[model samples]
Target: MDWTALWLSMRLAAWTVAILLPISVLMGRFLAYRQFRAKGMVEALVMLPLVLPPTVFGFYLLVAFGRNSPVGDLWQGLFGHQLVFSFEGLVVASVIFNLPFAVQPAQRGFEAIPVEVREAASCCGMSPLASLWKVELPLAWPGLMTAMVLTFAHTLGEFGIVLMVGGSIPGETKTIAISIYDKVQGFDDRSAGIMSAVLVAISLFTIALTYWLSARMGRRLS
Candidate 1:
């Protein structure tokens, strides 16, 4: 396996996690607590990526961020470059592709906390934001961590969107999944196996970490 692709994939996953963490946390909290008009519709929209085809997401992203569209041109004007065919593009695609992975778990975590706890905090005159930061977030820390790890892992495994938006730019956008695909296409079975093994090891380690953390959190909460 080319160490470069492994490194690139790791970098991409790390960046994706860093970018998605706060956004997902806020979204998860909103979905859990906010009862607004079309709340169900908002939840459905958030879950859409899970059911949407990866290629279709990639295709739309390409058009939306490509050099021609209004948003794309506006971005180009501000950034002096296009979003498509770049690492930045892959980051955007990964965020969109793996959004639900981060949101759903975090939302569930927030939901798991009793409403009475929030009510007690409110009774004590704590602002909503303060209650969230001091009460809800700590209780949901394990779930947040799980969401982050899972989202990172899922993005690392993404292929179609990365290929479409980033164009397999080796050393920049050629993540592990794309590299494995290329190796297999070129009949380089050995390299493909090596990459696959690495990915599997990482995924297994993550799953174990999540379970352990969840159990620990359960004990602590109890």
Candidate 2:
């Protein structure tokens, strides 16, 4: 097992979760509370990654972030390196690829908050943000927790997108999933099995913990 790849995968997942949590909260709240034009289209766009093939999505990302593209050129000029095949690039890809896993649950959570509670918060002169922070979030803790767990876990198992965007660069962009693929291709079945088992164990533990916490939060809310 490549410890560096394991560490990189953890780092990528952590960064993806950290960046998306607040963004998911905001997007989820908006979709839950707002009734705007093109809402369905926006929601569909947000969910596109969930349904789209990961490699296809990563191909677009590669183009968008490649040195030939405008964004890539600008990024390169400013940062002195292309975004493609970098750790930062991996984070960006992970965030996009796992966005729906984070956003959908959070949106559902926000929607579950009773209108009366929000009205009460309003009556008490709390701002919208304050109401969300104090009332809706407390009531919808389960959904938020689910989003975080799903996002982290989804990122851990990512393969096609990470491979397309970052390739397999040990300690730089090679994640555990990529490492596992490499091990298997190299005929290192023992290492591949060990890494695969570790991922399965981690994923199972995360899912179980999420469910347990969600159930507890539901009881508390009730």
Candidate 3:
């Protein structure tokens, strides 16, 4: 098994989850509270990753971040490099690809907060941010944990989008999922199986840990 690929995948998943968590909390809160025209359309757009093919999403990202495109040009001019075929590129792809897993769970968790409680907090003059930090967030811990676990798991298994944007550059853009694909293509079944088993074990352990921690915390809160 390629230990480098294994390490890269773990790194990517960790970073993706870390980045997604705060954004997910914000987006989730917005979706749960904000009301405006075209809100449904906006939600659909955010969820496009789930419905659209990963390749299609990856293609769009490639175009948007590739050299000669406006954002890409700006990025290159400022940073002195292109986003394509790099670790940053893979991270960008994974974030877009696994966003819904984080957002949806967070939204649901926030929604589970009773409306009257927010109203009561407002009656006491607590600002929206204060209420969110002191009241809403504490009640939504379980859902947030679910979001973190799901997002991490989803990112760990990401393939099509990462492959398209990252192009399998070893120790740079090659994640374990892509590495497993390379092993199969090379007829290295033993290595692929080893990596696959490792991924499966990690996923299972993460999910189990999330559940256990959440339950234990809930009991303590009770």
Q: Estimate each model's TM-score.
A: 0.94, 0.97, 0.95
Candidate 1 residue-wise lDDT, 1-222, digit = tens: 878988988888898899888988899888888889998888888889899888898899999989999878987898888888878878888887878888888998898889899899999999988998989998888879889988878887988888888998888889899999999999999999999999999989988988898888889878
Ranking by TM-score: 2, 3, 1
Error of 3 at 146 (Å): 1.1
Q: Global lDDT of each model?
A: 0.87, 0.92, 0.89
**1-222, model 2: which lDDT tens digit per residue?**
788999999999999999999999999989998999999999999999989999899999999999899988988999999799999989998998888999999999989888888999999999988987888889877888999999999999999999999988899999999999999999999999999999999999999998888788778867
37 in model 3: Cα distance from truth in Å? Answer: 1.2
lDDT of 3 by residue, 127-187 (tens): 9889988888998878889999998898889899999899988999999999999999999
Cα RMSD of all models vs. native, in order, equals: 1.4, 1.0, 1.3
Model 2: which residue pairs collide?
none
lDDT assessment of candidate 2: 0.92
Backbone clash total for model 2 is 0
Worst 10 residues of 1 by lDDT: 86-95
